[model samples]
Target: MKGFKEFLLRGNVVELAVAVVIGAAFTNLVNTFVKGVINPIVGAFGTKDLASYTSCLKGPCETGPAGEVTSGVLILWGSVLSAALQFLITALVVYFVLIVPMNRMAARRKSLAEEAVEAEAKEVKLLTEIRDALVAPLR
Candidate 1:
């Protein structure tokens, strides 16, 4: 269908897919930073290591219900924390990289339009003055 084709080709859908992929990859990077870099350094003083900080009592992986979470230890809050941090970082990066630049481009275009309008107005004013001067002699 034409509508389906249009939807498939829409820029927003493509952009959103790209953003989701990038965000997923970035989250992995943030997890590495939190687990390898931040966790050990901070865990030295804390009660548990980053990996064990959020674990499941009876689950294969603590991030979520592994196969069948028998007990809900809820130590997996550490990964949640890492995810939240990643989200904040992603938002800031997107705002600065994409939104800010887009706004600036729009503002620049508006300024150029205003300048062109002003130039046109000046030209009209000069033409009117010349016409009045010529008519004055005739009067």
Candidate 2:
């Protein structure tokens, strides 16, 4: 019971849980954006919509007698393009909005903390010296 409580209260575990939830939510948002926005843009380019684009091979392919696409790179590339675009956007957002700013803020806070500790130590040393001087006179 105690171990379970400790595990539940651990800061790292809580942070990890939040991160996982956020990651899952972010992926869903990206999927929606890609499906709704990016796919149309890609579709506007080469041939039909990139989301539905497929190769029409000549022999033993789609154009052949009573043949279908029978699988091609483009078939898989639809989702790939969507995922790639989302990944690029996510990377850019993380770099600019989250990672860079977080790093700078952490650095600033660390310097401030170090400075405070150093000042406190200096004050303590000065107080100790003054106490020793007073005791010496008394001796």
Name the top lDDT candidate: 2
lDDT of 2: 0.76
lDDT of 1 by residue, 46-132 (tens): 844544455555455333356444545555676676567667766777799899999999999999999999999999999999999
TM-score of each: 0.60, 0.63
What CA root-mean-square deviation does each model show from the true structure?
5.5, 4.4
User: Candidate 1 — which pairs collide?
Assistant: 54-75, 54-76
Backbone collisions counted per model: 2, 2
Per-residue error for 58 in candidate 2, Å, reads: 7.9
Scored against the true structure, residue 3 in model 2 reaches a CA lDDT of 100
Task: For model 2, state the Cα shift of residue 26 in Å.
Answer: 1.1
lDDT of 1 at 2: 100
Off by over 4 Å in 1: 1-51, 55-69, 72-75
Q: Give the per-residue lDDT of model 2 (tens digit) for 32-72.
A: 77777777666677543555544434443333356444543
lDDT of each: 0.75, 0.76
- Candidate 2's displacement at residue 109, Å, is 2.5
